[model samples]
Target: MSKSTSLLAAVALVVTGGVALADDTKVGILMDITGPIASFIPPLQNAANLAVNQANEQGGLLDGKAIAVFGDTTGSAQGAVDAAGKLVNIENVPIIMGSLMSGTTIAAAEAVAIPAGVVQISPTATSPAITDIEDNDLMYRIVPSDNYQGEVLAKMVLEAGNKEVAVTYVNNDYGVGIGQTFIEAYKAAGGKITSAVKHEEKKDSYRSELATLSQAGGSALVVIAYAGDSGGKIVKQSIEGGLFTNFIGTDGLRDEALINDIGAEALATSFFSSPTSPADNPNQGTLHELYNAAYGEGADKAFVDQTYDATFLTLLAIQKAGSTDRAAMAAALRSVASAPGEKVGPGEWAKARKLLMDGKDIDYDGAGGSYDFDKNGDVSGYIGKFVVDGNSYKQTEVMQ
Candidate 1:
């Protein structure tokens, strides 16, 4: 071969290698699209897409490299692990945002993210154990943990003059964490837990369990379960059996579909605790308007905005690190979320972009509230107390 021809071939090979290397700056989303939590999952998925779209429209993250892939967890632990593996191995994405359920998030953190050194940010997983697990430096959650929500729910029950409370929780990390915390806090606050029952998910009937709880001598019953067909059936059966006069729930039971399934009457005299107020978030007006315009309805009260914020935060970290290297991005996340800098909210993407171009640091206070991540990747937010008003929930108080 001639020397000139061989040199041209080598240059062509370098150009091809450079293009492949540039394409490595991909981001992945793992969410629950079809499962028991399907109703709440769609809005979150939409919010994530919206954030990524907005990011790309504004010249994309890391100088227009752009995010590349998205996937679903199906609201299961094994499913989450599989999704994470695909994102890291197949899609070659270094950052992932998803797996809304606490159990699934924890499973993915341990089985996939921690070992692989990928940054996993969850928008709705509230279990304290996610942050408490040993060496979980890669796992971050956007919402407040169940530790605060459980305490808030316990206080609401006691303040309502209910001295005796019975508890029923689903058999999962989220359920058990909230239920145990509430029981401890309620007892510590001079209240009594008459009985606590843990029910397995996907069961056909909970009538016998309801009967057992009814005989527990409590005037009020608190349910810590996911909101969906299973929760709807349990509430309907409880009301029909006249097992309890009042009911309460954690954030999992805040789904609007629950009311549609069991009707307003079944939810009468019931109260629940949510992490934040969707209607009152100052940072979410534009997001809410956009979601309504796209979906032809308001976004659900689940952690959709938080999901959006989590995805954006991950991208911000990638920009700050100036690379898709997972370890560097994980280290940058803590600095970008905490104080000593300007706060960025949902509608301030343009501002964040400008600041990034100017080489300025940003601290994002998300739609869910302050994104002040501690060493454990947790933040503090208020718990909202809501009562059933016809078919909707009316916010009665804010528990801090």
Candidate 2:
């Protein structure tokens, strides 16, 4: 072939390769939009979308290319695995955010991300086991682990003057992990646990389970389960069964759906702990305002703010790394989140973005609180306690 023909072939090859390189920066959002966790899922999904939109509006990462793909985890281990696989294989997304449930997150990390070299940042998966899993450097979470929350719960119950507590938890990673830690802490703190019951999810009724706790005669009942319809049923049944003891709950029960499902009257006397202080939280107010404007009222849920912060932090990491390479992005995540620098809040993304552009490192103080992520990607934040009154939660105290 002549020199002209050879030059034309080389140009075609360059253009084709450019198209492939351009596609490599796409980000994946893997979330639970259905199943038991749907109540919390929508808001978290909205948060992720809001972060991506804000980033793009501010000129995006890596020269105007923003996050692209979104997939649903369906709130199951199997579903998360499948979603991660699809995102990594079909969508070719190197960076993924999601699988909120600990079990589902672990499954996705082990079954898909680690093997595929995809970086997964979970906004709400709190099981300590997640970070403890061997060779799970790719896994990260924005929320404090159940280990801290469990100890917080135990201290909350102890301070509430509850000496004997009855524990009831959902038989899953999130539930069991917190429950076990709470038990250990409570016992070590000189409190006695009268009984422990682990219930399966999707049960029609927890009347018998509640009966067991009621009969245990504990001063307070600590529930470690998702605040889904089933959890609501259990709470209501426990209340109606004349188990009027004080109720303590973890982050999993910090959802609005619980009040809606069990009605305000039944949930009136309950107290629960969440990762953030929503009532006086400046970040929450900003998120609420933005969310209400975009999706109307009642869009902010327990993990929604953390989810937003997690996405923003990931984007910031990608910008810091100057590429979407999963491994580099993962290291950047640790660098940005782990302390010793300037703090950035939810509404201050523009400033953070500017600093990033100026080649200055930043530490993001998320809506969830001091997001000083450890080497294992776990955050340390104060747990806020709330009391249910009517259809809303009123922040009572900040548990240190």
Would you list the C-alpha lDDT of every candidate in the order shown? 0.76, 0.75
What is model 2's C-alpha RMSD? 9.2
Model 1 per-residue lDDT tens digits across residues 232-350: 66787887887776788877888887888877886788888988744566777766776677656645456767887888887788877877777787778887787666778775667
- All candidates' TM-scores? 0.89, 0.87
Span of ten consecutive residues with least summed lDDT in model 2:
9-18
- Alpha carbon deviation, residue 233, candidate 1 (Å): 2.5
Q: What would the C-alpha RMSD of candidate 1 be, to one decimal place? A: 9.1
Q: How would you encode candidate 2's per-residue C-alpha lDDT over 1-400 as one tens digit per residue?
A: 2352233222211111123345336677777666676667555656777787777666766775565466666678887888788888887776888778888889988999988887888888888898787645788887778889888888888888889989998898888899899999999999999999999998888988888888878877888888774566677777777774467788778788887777777666678987774345677677778777876755446777878888887787887888767778777787777576677777566787788778888887666665666777776766788888667777788865
Supply the global lDDT for candidate 2.
0.75
Name the best candidate (by lDDT): 1
